[model samples]
Target: MQEFEPATDQLDEAWDAIQHVADLQDAWAAINPQGEQQRLDDQLDRNLVQDSDDEFAEMEVPELQSRQNIHQGDQPRCAIETCDPEITEEQAQHMMRQLNEKQRQVFNHVSKWCDDKARDQSVDPFQMFLTGGAGTGKSHVIKCIQYYAKKVFARMTESAEDMTVLSLAHLGTAAFNICGQTICSGLKINPKSQKEYKPLGEESLNTLRVKYRHLQLVIIDEISMVSTTQLTYIFGRLQQIKGTYTDFGNVSILAVGDFYQLPPISPPTPLCFPHDEILKDIWNPLFQIVELKEIMRQKDDAIFAQMLNRLRERKKKQPLQKTDKELLESRRVEENNLTAPPDALHLFYLNKDVDSHNERKLASLNTEMFTIKANDVDQRGGRIIQVHETPHRTTRADDTSLASYLKLAVDARVMLIANVDVSDGLCNGVPGIVKGIEFCNSQNMPIVVYVKFDSDRVGAKTRTTQFIPPHYAGCVPIKPRKESFKVRGRTFTTTREQMPLKLAWAVTVHKVQGQTTDQAVISMKGLRKSMAYVALSRVTHLEGMYLMDYDESRIFCNEDIEANVAKMPTCDLSKANPLTEIDHNTNFVIAHHNIQSLHRHIDDLKRTQK
Candidate 1:
């Protein structure tokens, strides 16, 4: 019998090594189960000591351990090949280099862990979390990781081929475009009705399983926008199709997005919860955690960046200096009221002049253009104002009154160069040219308009009609109402119903929640106490906030304020570690395999042609 006591230092090193080995094993099992188990068994068998020894036998243990480690570490990396033309190797390298030191390290760590597991034939880590503030290069880093994987696949393949890299955005239209693009490129399907692309369902799965049973990764961007329910659906579908061949009974998912920004909107449920709940429910155990710290966008504006960071922290406002107070007042004047007469601000205040004699009041606010003087003297103010309008008359019951008002406002200012705010079925702040207008009723009211907007594909021409209520008279049959609207010297028909009402720039705090302005006129006087904090936080500097009859105490003392502060996630990056060599190798292998599969398919086509 041998009595062996491992030194404390040696024990610590051994434990670290074992933990690393275990991580690798877990990743390997995810990719290649049979191979992983066999390798583990072989290592155990080789490491088992049968000889009985004296007091010096402990010295032999370290040598035996080293042999076992070496034997278990020599397996080939797992490879995944892609066949999509969207991503290139040079592009991937460029993206990877963009990552900050901390992010790069974390990526490398995950890659190594995945690679080690592949070598050991064990389950591979399939999920990862990349957390950071705005401008932290989180999105950029994830894109690089995706590109790197694709590039590695291309490089390792025998025949040069591209890999499938689907990059989905978090919002509307973008989501559809991403999925459509993937289907178009990967499945060779057209979206047009006559040439509609139909997924082959089980057949497609079978083909993929036969050709790419060793597929390595599926990277999903904007993961924060995806609900757990949606994720479960995606995973469930993958599990059903890939079945046993799935790396972890599904594809290795790399989801990247900021959790703080707008979260998933569907189902109207909260996206983020307490850390404990997140860890237990939303956080996948296989996910390797990585937090990026460097602020890339606002690096030059440190003070502005700090203000944003503080805003995220939900810090209370301190007393402001005189200059700050002045700045705040200026901002309030700019953001809260309509720049022109009959502004939304006037509507808010219900000014008698603006409400009773709208036509006369709006006519006097003529458009003027002037530049600031070079001499220190201030020229007439050159501030831009936003106006919102809603039509008073309804042409149809279903017609959106807001749309008619927006069209009328835009038409009124077609030549004046004023920014018009139209709260249509589009994302806020989406700007487009007002191309043409058409009258819908006998009164020559403009109901439908044509808009040409730029999209990923090309400039799309879309015709949107304002929801008209039934009471409004249809276009008068006796005579066509003639109105002049011009864009680039092209005259278009306009309607008499179009009123030149000034729009007050007003958006719910939630809509403008994450944005910061140099100055803001926040109107929280009548709003619920819960919403006051949101309105106040919209400004960057304390001086930027213009309080319009706001209850300072209500905003500062609201229960929601406390809740928001308590709910804010702590963003500490001091404890993060760098990625290991094994991670890089694993990522390389997965990329290689994916590219190889695609190349093989291309080669088969060539052979058939010959």
Candidate 2:
């Protein structure tokens, strides 16, 4: 240690304080920003930082701007000065007047909240957690806000700077439906990594810094499927890349999902408020919470909506009325009606069952099966397609057995798994038939499959997708769903790719969430729990629901299957021996009381015939 240069009398105390400040600045200056940020981010992932305001104030950190500091990416959106809202309260009310009373209320609440955020200088942008049951217009409200925000920003400035108001989803189908990027792609996750908690590497952090430099608002749809650990990283990494010490770095986060729905397959983590400490920390600060009660999809059928609400909440069921029980029973397609053109959409509880059923159906059709092995290669250009087999746990593509290869016959009932073009109605769950295929050359390797969506779905037009293989290195424009999970003390990655089409003759209930079917035959054999209710709710009307070999007990999901893993951050910080087994079992639940509105209000539910 260097000998201290003493100041005269009381000046020594002041000299020591000044020396400490210089030392702190020098310490920060010595470290690389990117590495320091990553270290801090990882620290956030593993600890609940308990710094007092005064402690942080004493640090020699650079002062961050209240707004417009999230990112400037390659594209700069509107300047903060020019992005003020012009929507008057009257205009907002007028725009939402077409919605139902409940919808209008939620819309107005979110509209005004977003409006204030657009003009306010509180540092944090607009954020929300919009939750609701199926058909509650969660998606509708998101779209409305997206449209309104654009108009407000446009009216403020003439220059279009690619002001991004984007939607992000945990899965490819959801992202595609919203015309947005997947969380994995946006955040820079190494899909091939064998680690469950893949933090953002420098490359990923830098990429996010550039790509989303101008990112405005982020809407995470289907939040239930995203694990808490995954979300923790998203929050922490975004803050790190944006260089803001504030929560979410002053960027807005609109999280939309129903916990009653299925959670992410691996780790099977469903985000619950307050209970999940890490998620709670990420959600700290100003976020408008909105739960839409009215069922916009089933607006005319108050009874159906009530039943769904009760079922979704897992409430103790009241004795079924004789007529109500008969109504559900009568809707079950007997052998005579089962084979009709408007066949019930088959819902299977197991992946194997769905695969075997669809395969058998296609085999029985007496058509030639075309097989296309996926084109997979390592970074060195060596083919890892078959050479390096990844141990599979459970994922959307793994369950289908199409990540490596896809086999299909013409005229098979199918569902478009990826969005080909939303404008023309090429979207997930649009039940259709595979009309034919076009091969690459005379050698007859498959290229594109022509599909004709149901007239009721796409207004009678053919949609075509060029068969693209998954570049494990992610070379192609199309990014397949990357499913990560843990098995036997290591993280493993599995990519599901090639066929954007899945057999529609039978689909898993989780696959069919956020969809409506005129008729559905839900088989409840071997269900984990409460998923039967989810399957049953897909039918637009009660009369269209069919149950095959169903049991009432299995209709409620198997609550025992839910994983009770300790919080990841806490686990990482603990001193004791860590959990050797990380169970990625697929179990889910929303242990909340029934919605009060389920007790139908005669006045509130009176339907108007349009």
Candidate 3:
């Protein structure tokens, strides 16, 4: 009021300064939400704030709760805390105790009575030959020995030491994998030069040898599958690699298998004789032979097993017609004629018609069939058919409608057959149901009837079509038919290697030679032949083989029994032959010399290059 002359200018300056300060505050608040939020709204997006709080709170509670739970009680114990109910600890201890006693007695006897030479640090290695009938506990006993060795080694050696176990097979991909090492049956040596071209490096074979050198024992399963030549090669390689390490080299090798099974395939010669030197020397004094007599797999059906055993022992002689054989044959024929609800039949023909000019004309109808063989069907009356010519060829009266007839016999069953003539002609056995029929170009022009074949045989469901020719244009599907019959037929003989062309009824023994069957109705008549003897033995179990005739002589033969007994080599492991030590030393020395020569040759090459 006192400075009224310049009051207006002073008031304007204050107002402008206040406005600038307010603008600066607003810009700062915009960058920082918490500060702006307080001024903007009292309840600032409660949903967003509460959602985050709930998540973090939930996480915190669970962490604290879990910690508390862990502190509350100890973890649940293993199921094996107590002895197994089926086998008590006492029983196990008793069995183990007996085994241990036997082992100790043998060890004591060897330690006391064995010659001073045998007691030397360089004790000649002992080999074991374990043979057994199929399903015996041979493999189990060897596995037990391996387990014992592993335990003993673990107890004797440091904890850091490694161990390996291996089981090798004769063929295919089933091989042993242990501690980064694999032992397979066959080596891929060049056929022309039976030399080991693929060399093992220091990192591969040498490293494996080092890691497993201390291995106490090795158990070889299915030893029967190993050829004598292959065994000798493997043994030679092992001896060469471990020759320097006396302590680690003296590893135990246990082999278990049925000797009566298939033998090794050897090279052909003018006179057929066992060419395998190893096979001949299998009964060498170094081996400890153990034969397992207990049959485990066939224990459930003892009677049936005994019956099969008898049959296996029987000799091949003259055919004997028995009541069982007649009954089996009759049953087979009856099964073939059962054309009931589940077994429906359908037939298709490749209709061929010639024009007035004597020229061959293709039919408009076409079909294809797919068939799966049934195990019980009679060979003569079942779904088998022999095609006289290619499916494309013109159908004649004597052309043999075998395929067509088989299709009519079996109803509601699927059939798959190959080879169809014209694209427009009738195609039979192609999977799929006919949906609809239509014609194009001319109404009378050969109607292309499309047939779809449905099958899961080729992995997934598929549909294929065929074009019908003008000649068999009249062929059409029945309309609104109930309880329709679908016939299934198969072409027995074909030119293809995979497909068999001829189908005929034969005794099971004749057909199943060198083949395996889950269930077979074998005729006693066929059992008299040598081929039948081979066929019956193909099955692994007695239950797998069925006999049609129950003749004592058919199932058990004195000659066959004698033959098996003769095959069992008299392996006297206790006695030592004079040539044994000499042979072993000779083999070892030869291998050593060869290895030295190889090393010298390599060194010379390297020096020359430098």
Highest-scoring model, TM-score: 2
| Cα lDDT, model 3, residue 108 | 26
Span of 10 residues, lowest total lDDT, candidate 2: 60-69
lDDT of 2 by residue, 244-334 (tens): 8766766778788776676655446455534344425444344445567778767788888777776665533445555545555665555
Error of 1 at 118 (Å): 9.3
**lDDT winner between candidates 2 and 3:** 2
* Root mean square deviation (Cα) for candidate 3: 32.0
Model 1, 505-561: lDDT tens digits are 333333332333444445544543324444444333444345665443333222232
Candidate 3 accuracy as lDDT: 0.32
lDDT for each residue of candidate 3 in 17-114, tens digit (9 for 90 to 100): 66445544456667985555343322211111110101112111000000000111422110000112124444533433433222322222222222
| lDDT pick, better of 1 and 3 | 1
**Reference-based lDDT, each prediction:** 0.37, 0.52, 0.32
Q: 563, model 1: CA deviation in Å?
A: 12
Q: What is the Cα-based lDDT of residue 598 in candidate 1?
A: 75
For each candidate in turn, the TM-score is 0.44, 0.62, 0.37
CA RMSD of each candidate after superposition: 28.0, 19.4, 32.0
All candidates in order of lDDT, best leading: 2, 1, 3
Off by over 4 Å in 1: 1-98, 110-123, 155-163, 173-215, 245-248, 266-288, 315-430, 437-610
Ranking by TM-score: 2, 1, 3
lDDT: worst 10-residue window of model 3: 61-70
Q: After superposition, how far is residue 369 of candidate 3 from its true place, in Å?
A: 14
